[model samples]
Target: MKKVIGWSLGIYLVFGLFIAWYLFLGANTDIPAQLKGSPADPQTFMNERELLLSEEYSKIKNLLFFLSVPFEWLIYTLVLVIGISAKFRDWSKVSAKFSILQTAIYLFWLSLLVEVLSFPLSWISYNVSKTYNITVQSTQSWMKDLLIDFWVNYALMILIVGVLFWLIRRNEKRWWFHAWLLSIPFSMFLMFVQPVIIDPLYNDFFPLTNKELETKILEMADRADIPADHVFEVNMSEKTNSLNAYVTGIGSNSRIVLWDTTLQRLNENEILFIMAHEMGHYVMKHIYIGIAGYLVLTLVGLFIISKFMSFMIRKWGHIFKISSVKDIAVLPVFLLLISVLSFVSDPVSNAVSRHQEKSADLYALEMTDDNKAAVSSFQELSKAGLSQVNPPFLVKIFRYGHPTMLERITYTNEFEKSEE
Candidate 1:
């Protein structure tokens, strides 16, 4: 018990120090003179209305941001308690005599319970987005999506739990390492199929209808040495008013995707810049980099879970009604550990994403040699998405996957200045 507690504390401290050091002393890009402004004052770059809207949006989002972590932890803990207190293990035994099937059944029920408990939070989020005029989806559509998500999640939980327990049963001593090995190919397989299979299940995707713009985007792709073939457009406006574009898949499946909202809201030059930015992600191999990072993190996370899971089960097994680490009822406890690790390590992951995004921004500027277009595109994006120009430091550290609007705009300004 003491050893487990000590290791837990050590992990927390190490991650905490890493986050602090990275945020405070890491190699951050400099904010250019032209883009610097007090948060209290409206910048000349954005109109007064736009600035006011951005501030209001920032306040709402920041509140949600701060509330989400604790709220999620609380909900997860509650579910764990409820599942254990309810003697889900007994129910699982009655439902299925086979251990693997019992585990799967228990996992599915627990997952469904979590989803039901968490639905209120999801509903609130949607309501808030609607209040801010960000979301365009109707209640019926939203509910439909939620239903789809629940079933999909339930199916996935069963499969994952079944495989995980199988691995544990197969290799009691080295299950974590084996699970990590299995995850590599599984992750790759998901990436390969996601664009072609999973994505289409959620939203409608079509080839870009604008022949002229498609030609222009392909030309830009050609210039970046990315394969020129097709650009896909997703009907995101059906759900949200926000603008977005991305590069997804790998090898033969690789493609550029744009939101229909982005096409409608941004000009030709701005869209070009956005496409260029996504192209940067492809050309820089950020996808592979991200996959490599996930592989390492997964290995470490699984190892940590293995180290302390036995101790945790021994200490609380009677109280929680869980017999052992391999019990179906222990799934929630396993999920709890992984979730805690993920929450603590979020800043590191976000920092890596921000770094990639910054690199992509720079690549876009160089590829197009159009600083004004890049800056304007970012401005439009920030406005459309209601993004904070300069968010609080903690928010930036914890939540931001890309640099704030202020940072990107300033970076472009500096790029232009350096050219001069």
Candidate 2:
């Protein structure tokens, strides 16, 4: 346990230093010069100040993403190594006669510990966004949201852990498969209610008050064969300066939500194009595809984890203070495996998302028949968010779910040429 903890902490110390250098000393690094065609090219869409800010801003956010994954994994591993999970396991049984009650008790401490340990990264991310004027959410409100996030996820953890342990105890050998099958409905239920039930907890949503804009969006919806009668606008400007619109939910719960910031910042045509782009997802059934893909990945991931959990328990179970995969103490090991494997699978998932986003972009251009709006809306998006037009390879692979601004703009340019 000491050796494992020592090696893990040692690895992070070295990695943390490199991330520090990359952010501070290497802020001057022209990492995107290759993609941009030249360093600080004056001919770019953004002015000099915006370009410079985007470079630094994008780098910090992207680097933090890379840094946090392993940090989270380490925290999970440390808990198991130091017997925190074991301690919790014992504590959970002290008063709880029922296994479900014990599971909830153990999970509350485990979830709280994980959240507290991982919070510095969360704070650092918030601070960076706050410093850059990206977020307008007050520190008080931010903390409120954090607390809400904690409880919400805690409740979810209780449900998930309860189901998992029940399966493990009842069907030890095929528990992962059974759990994965159960998750299909559970996951879909979450998606279905997310827009109506989950999302409203964080922000207020209302029908687009701009009747003119609402009419335009509704008309576009009609043209696209989308059943949305109302376009919802959420008051996100209170929290962030960024602009966005997205399609969420399924069936009657389906919504194309516009951030109030998007309405405040972008013009009607840009908003229409953005709406059309979002509508493309519904028309193309991307949401269903995404959900299906998630289930498929879960099926595969859980299978691998089951195999790994069996092998790891046999070899290092004693070190982790757990005798078997069914042991409640093995929860941290389960989460750590998930974190590590999910990190490894990120590029593949992100690549698929990017492809779907590009398809939507093409659909928008065709629907709107306005390459100029498509291009300028992307430019406005990049400007408002201080987004990097061309990101580095690592960021592209791991962080980007949509095409970079440069790639998006290039597509419109190609469309314009074809029309000519």
Candidate 3:
């Protein structure tokens, strides 16, 4: 017990110190004198006040972002070390007549505890966004969304937990393989239903209201062979000032969703470039590829998790107050391992995503043949989102899924110059 506690404290210190070092001292923020005058210049993308606000806002956000992963691990480690999970496991015995219900009860309490413990960070994040005028959502709306998210996440996780324990009981050695097999279709089903079903719970979505703009987008979709029958737009300006567009779902239910904020903030040409970028994802089959990659990662992750979890339980089950692989109390250990693995693998995932996004950017350029619009659109996105055009290397590796704003703009500008 002393050893476990010491190890947990050691990890927390190392993670916290590393995040502090990279965040404060790793990257220079200076903009080159020549680049200072350009719209894509991170330092000059906004007015004086906006620039100041963006700098302060990005700093707070970066601190929160870097801390979030290890913070979760900390929570799980604390929960495990304190025997709270064992309490949850024993408390759920009242529902043991129904094993499924017992499993659900244990998971619900465990997840709820995590959320309650983590709410302060969520509140800090919300207040920061609100202070910077990034989000316009009120306290009531934000809390409502929080509840919705909790329930949605709980619903999915309960299903996963039930399958996991059932597999362990049936065949402890093969559970990981069987669980991985089950996750593939389960993942696909969620993707298929997300845009059509899950998304509407949070925001309204309908065919784009500006008929003329919608027509142009639909035509672009046709040219790209995306088979998108309608362009969808969500009422996002009510909650956020961020400009965005995205591709969501798959097959017949697939959608090209634009934030109404995007339409309000950008010109038709810029909107076309944004929409074309989304269409590029569809044309390139990035969605299918992403799904395949997720499955492969899960397969490997589950295998490793299963082995490590069993070993931890076998070696320290007494210390953990966990009796067996089938004990629900072992979950925190499982979660801790998963979190660490994800943090380690995050850079590789980000690199792959950046490559995909870069490809989508070039595809949009080819489809639109408008370098000016492409470059300007990325600049506008950075300005509106108050994003650092070139964040620190570690920050970019962990948090950014797309190329840096400067990288995208430079690539687009270079493409134009090459053509000329």
Candidate 4:
């Protein structure tokens, strides 16, 4: 046990120091010339006030983002300690007497504990968003959404944990492989139903009422080789003032959705640029590619968990009151391993997403042939969402799924320059 603890501490310390150095000292922070515009130009995309607000907003948000990682690790560690000390093993044994009811109770309590521990951070995040004028949802509405999120998450956790443990009990050695196989179908199922079942639970969705804008978007979609059909508008104004458009689902369940705020806020040309970018994602099959990437990552993550979990359990099972991998009390330990792995692998994930986004940006430029619109659209998006035009390189590597606003704008300018 001491050896295992020593190994874990050593690895964490080395990794933590390396990450800190990479983020603060080693990463590039340069902005390309194409992205820099003269203040003397009358058509400077971002005004002085916008740039100042964006810088301040990014600083606050980035600080919170970095701080939350350690806070979450501490919270999860505390939960594991408390769960073990609180007789979770005895509780699991008693609950098993009632069949699967024990799994349900154990998961419910565990989830509730995590939620309670996490609520303060969540509250602070919401308040910060409000303070920055990013969100418009009232306190009551936000709380309602939080409650809804909890129950939905609990329900899903119950299903996943129940099935996962059943697999482990059936085949202790290869359960990880089987679990990975099962996750593929489960992920697809969630993707298929989310647009209809899950999303509507939080916000209203309806066919876009603006016939003129709908027609324009459909025309743009047609140019991008996406099927022409209805465009859905979500009532995001009820919750947020930020503008966004997205493509969701797969095959027949697939649809393009625009926020009502985007429709109300952006000009037709800017909206066209945004729609084209989303269509680029669909036409390029990014969603399918993203799913494939997830499949690979999950397989690798599960394999790692399988290899180490047993050794750890053998060494400290008594201390944790967990006797086997099949015990529900081990869930927190499993989650802790997963959380650590996910953080370690975030750079790979973010890099892939950034590549896809960059491709989409280029596709939008080609499809729209409106460099000005494309650049202006990103400028508007950054201003409205309070995005940093020049995010630190470490933030870009770890947190950014798309190129920074400046990067996108610079790419557009470079593309135009090449053509000229």
For every candidate, C-alpha RMSD to the true structure in Å: 5.6, 2.5, 1.9, 3.6
lDDT of all predictions = 0.78, 0.86, 0.86, 0.80
Clashes of 2: 0
Please list all clashing residue pairs in model 2, or write none if there are none: none
Model 2: residues >4 Å from true position, as ranges? 18-43, 416-420
User: Model 3: per-residue lDDT, tens digit, 123-223?
Assistant: 99999999889999989989999999999998988888888889999998999999999988899899999998899999999999899999999899888
Q: Which has the greatest TM-score?
A: 3
Residues 226-268 of candidate 2: C-alpha lDDT, one tens digit per residue: 8878999999988999999998888788999999999998888
TM-score of 1: 0.88
Considering TM-score, which of the candidate structures 2 and 4 is the better prediction for this target? 2
Among all candidates shown, the one with the greatest lDDT: 3
- Give all TM-scores, in the order shown: 0.88, 0.94, 0.96, 0.89
How far out, in Å, is residue 179 in model 2? 0.6
Which of candidates 1 and 4 reaches a greater lDDT?
Answer: 4
- Rank candidates, TM-score, best first: 3, 2, 4, 1
1-420 in candidate 1: lDDT tens per residue? 345445555655565555445434552433445545622123655687877776667666656555555555555555544454246667788888887677766766676777776777688888888988889899999998888887877777777778988888788779999999999988998889889988888899989999999999999888778876899999998899999998888778887899999999888988998998999999899999999999999999999998777887787776666667777667767888888899889999999999999999988888788888887887777878777776767778878999988878777866852364
lDDT, residue 142, model 1: 94
